[model samples]
Target: MKTSLPIFVRNSMYALRGGFLVRPLLISLALGLAGMILSSAEERFPVVSAWVPDALFPSHADPQVAQVMLSTIASSIMTVVSIVFAILLMTLTLASMQFSPRILVNFVRDHVTQWTLGVFLGTFLYCMAAMPAARSLPQPFAPVATVTGALALALASVMGLIYFIHHISRAVSVNHIVDRIARETERVIDELMPRKRGAVARGEDMEFEPEETEFAVLNVRSGYICFIDTTRLLKLAKAHKLRIRVLRPIGHFAPEGAPLFTVSHKSRLTAELDRDFRSAFGIGPMRTMQQDVEFGVLQIVDIALKAISPAVNDPSTAINCIDQLTSILIRWAERAPPATIFSDPPYVVRVILPWPDFKHLLDTAFEQIRHYSANDVAVSLRLLRAMDDLAATLNDDSMRKEVTLCGRRVVANCATRLDPTNLKRLEDRLASLEARSPSFATRGA
Candidate 1:
């Protein structure tokens, strides 16, 4: 169980970061507790009646007025909470139907929406927490300051509701959605690949020799490998004097009883060590942006595919998606990917892992769109332009070649489906991409 602690904590943090419940729930609870504490203090000391001017609350001493105000604020704020939730559900539904269902994750991660829910619920809880203190018990005691605070919160909730509506209105735009995904993908790129280009060789593969007695570590359950704690794995390997090789990459499914990793020495492995090895991986039902760059790319691709589908046929949206995808690829092209091998001391390998290379990411981002948008001239042209833009940004000859080849595939796929005039447009875009590549410059000439 100790070995699983890191995985549990990592997964919990990821859940809290992406989830909508934790922040709002904590905000509401904190506000409610604060309201309770403030009201209790005011009731005990009568601070408001002593310092507050009479004009502000002529009925400061009237417990009945305080009770009524607290009740009204609490009920009204609850009503607003209902409306906020209703609007949120409707917006999510509309977005899911109009856009791709996968994008709901983006909406769920929106801080604005989460804070809107928090503020509204927090106002309601604040009033409720202060309501009991407004009672005219033995001596008609009224916490005037608490009542004033409730009134202020009610006004703020009103303003919040207005802003929430405005935010939701704009959050549903496809352009906003695609741009957000692109930014998130770039953020992940910065995190996973922080090293400057040339800090690590572009195509350097980690070399390690496994012993014949190596044993497989089977996964206990079936799920997608969302995250791996490489540091912990390396530490474990170094401590045990073993070499570890991960059999599955992030974003790949690990079936129950399937080999998740292989160890150099089976005789050194124990049950505790096995648990530790398993704990280093965070598996989940679906992929997340935590470590899966392809997940982000797929989200945009999903939007593009839906846009260019026969049912939607919205080529402009597809084009926008392509543009954003190009931006994400550009950022990726400039950075060095996470190292596949982790070493404790120089020249000593502790762990060996697999990461998707640039070519795989390019295919993950554009391959499906290429197949789906074959006959659509507008989307096909935009795809070629995206490839050309990526080619210009990439310094690696092989990466540029990959982009050019993808562009060729785009043109080739379109040839069988499009008429001569449409084919000419795609071919022209492909030629333009080739012109930018050193290998194909003569062909373009």
Candidate 2:
């Protein structure tokens, strides 16, 4: 019994699938078959008998009767054909819209020529089938079938001409080129928007908390909502040639000093509500998992770097430290996945300076460390300036986040501000030299 049930269920599923795949094709075939049958009947009867003079079509047997019969057949056939064509065209369009909007848009944009050709072909076919007769004079003994054929030909010609006119009109709109582009862009954006576990759905008001670590704030200035720097955004827009009027979008950090928006506890209106009433709040948090991981790594680097020293080290040691640090930084910087590095704030700059440049900096710093014993205020200040410049280039939250994350991973520092294990690790490595100065001077004297 169990085996039989499973077999039944599988057969039912197969039937459902087959029904969907076969239904439309069957319907179209049925429609075409019906048309062909009617056309065959018309051919056999052949109203307006071949080459018969119009004069022979008796005035007593009203030509209007034959005309009406032929007109009815042609009209019915044309209606069916139009309906079938419309359905097929719409099906193609819908399929493209779902799977390949760009392709669909391009097809629409370039369809003018195709449409024209279709119309012309349709017109030519009707002309050939119509078999228009040339007669010098009318006869009193004209057959009714001759009149019908002539009428059908006239009707077909009219329809063909109309189709041709409609086809040519597409050229004016150029097959709706601009409209197709706009549709394709919207479709792409819809597919690409974040759809994570906590993402906000369409048409919902965003609510944010004051201390939400992943929330975004937006600021509007000069009729533009300045999310990140306008110049950078404008440059990207120009390069990509995008036409989006972004009021606000996901992954963009607000400008500096921007006020974060939140749900209000209360608002003054003409009506009074219960004292316990609460405002609704909702917002999709930014994806910061990668950022957090990177930051943790940077912290590790800071700890390690603080344990190393340059004051008592050989020149080669300094060079090695610099080279190793550069390698570590570059590896972290390049390891960022997807667009996460540019999505949020605290951008960390992670990269190695070029060969000669990195080597030169190391050599220069090593000379100062040996001569001044890591106690040189000028050298410390110089290092501070370089670090500040890097931080400045981060300029915004996105860059800062990435750089800080990379820094934490590759550079290590000690509580004493020196390389705790090596003088280069801590922030106060210079202070160590100061502490040693008195003992050194006494010994020298």
Candidate 3:
């Protein structure tokens, strides 16, 4: 039940990357502090002051010029920062209103956007910190090198602003958003399931016997189960000589006092063990990409759902979502899923956890959209084509069968709502899916 160090570090990193604040703030502060130190050194050390080229600052002796330049740059940069933030907020507002609100998370996590804020604020901080060094007090000192650095930063900020404008423009596009989600989900899949396609050893499923003396450990908090430290769970179970069954999977909601896990050999449980158990499961109000693949899938699904809704009625956007979902599913199908049963020693099972299988993930990725887009012929056709693409990629017969069944469902729903011509198109796509599977082809024949 005790969380391991690795899991704690991973969770901390996930939290750090969740928003746009921590990194940018740190960068700005670091740059600001550096500017103060560098300017101070340049003023105190005449040798360092000698490094400043005469061409850059013709009047290095007169501190007023440097003071005016640094102050103006700082003030102007702050103004630009305000404008940049305003534009960002407006863009996010428009994107949220037009697309899904969930997409705001994606925008917040964008590196370009984060760097944009950081560079702008960093430039402002740099100029401000260097301004005080350009004073005309006891001995007039300009800190020309420091002023030059501030000017360079200002130029970089200008370039960054241009890039930020370009990046934000594309980022607000639905296609870019969906593609970004797919890439992120695929990266998670690669990390979680490192084995290449068809590389996993296929063995007969092992049956687990129920433990005689089992006790349910109640959850202390009510929130979505964002991540479960499976390795830690396995190690804890091994150390205690117990078997553990995780009641709630990642992306599932666990109410307070609900059974979080069931541990065998209940007599061995102690207060420390219970605390460890609770700590191993990271429950939060919102889902993260830590171990929750469904969260990413749902992000895209949310967009598609909103696009095809009665109010939006944008079939093209829904189709784009389907295309991206297809890419995500294909990548997912190609990777071996993480093992559900974690064993400590060779074959000694210590932890039994439920991970979403390919079929369940397929359902999550397409089912809701399928239900919502049943009547939309364009969306329905794209859904079938997506399933067909997935079916073609999967090497397992059962997996192909699942895809075929999902395609059939789309066809069934479309037939119920579409005209003859649209239904024919749907049937043709369904046939393509069935043709990929020998079992489906035999049944059809």
Instruction: Work out candidate 3's RMSD over C-alphas.
Output: 2.1
- For model 2, the superposed segments whose C-alpha errors exceed 4 Å read 1-39, 45-116, 129-179, 191-445
lDDT of 3 by residue, 1-445 (tens): 2244656676777777767778899889988998899898986787876877888888989899988898888889889888878878998998998888888888888888888788878888888888888777786788888888888998998899888889888989999999999899888888888887667653226565566677999988899998887777877888898888888788999999899899888888898888887778888888888788889999999999999999999999999988988888888888877655546455566787777888998999999998998888888888888888888778899999999998888888777788999898888778888999888885454
Q: Model 1 over residues 1-445: C-alpha lDDT tens digits?
A: 8768878888888788677789899989988998899899997887545776678778877889988888888888888788778878887898888788889988888898888788878888888898888877677788888877887888888888889889888989999999999999899899888987789753245456546676788889899999999988988898998888888888999999899998989889998888888888999998888898888999999999899989988999999999999998888888887656656565666787788888999999999999999878888899998898899888888899999989989998988899998898888888889988788886543
After superposing candidate 3 on the true structure, give the runs of residues whose Cα lies further than 4 Å from its correct spot.
Answer: 1-8, 201-204, 442-445
Higher-TM-score candidate of 1 and 2: 1
CA RMSD of all predictions: 1.8, 24.4, 2.1
lDDT of 3 at 443: 41
**In model 3, what lDDT does residue 442 have?**
57
Estimated TM-score per prediction?
Answer: 0.95, 0.21, 0.94
For this target, which candidate reaches the highest TM-score against the unseen true structure? Answer: 1
Per-model C-alpha lDDT, please?
0.85, 0.33, 0.84
In model 2, the Cα lDDT at residue 113 comes to: 31
Candidate 1: stretches off by over 4 Å:
201-207
Judging by lDDT against the true structure, name the best candidate: 1
TM-score-based ranking: 1, 3, 2
The TM-score of predicted model 1 comes to: 0.95
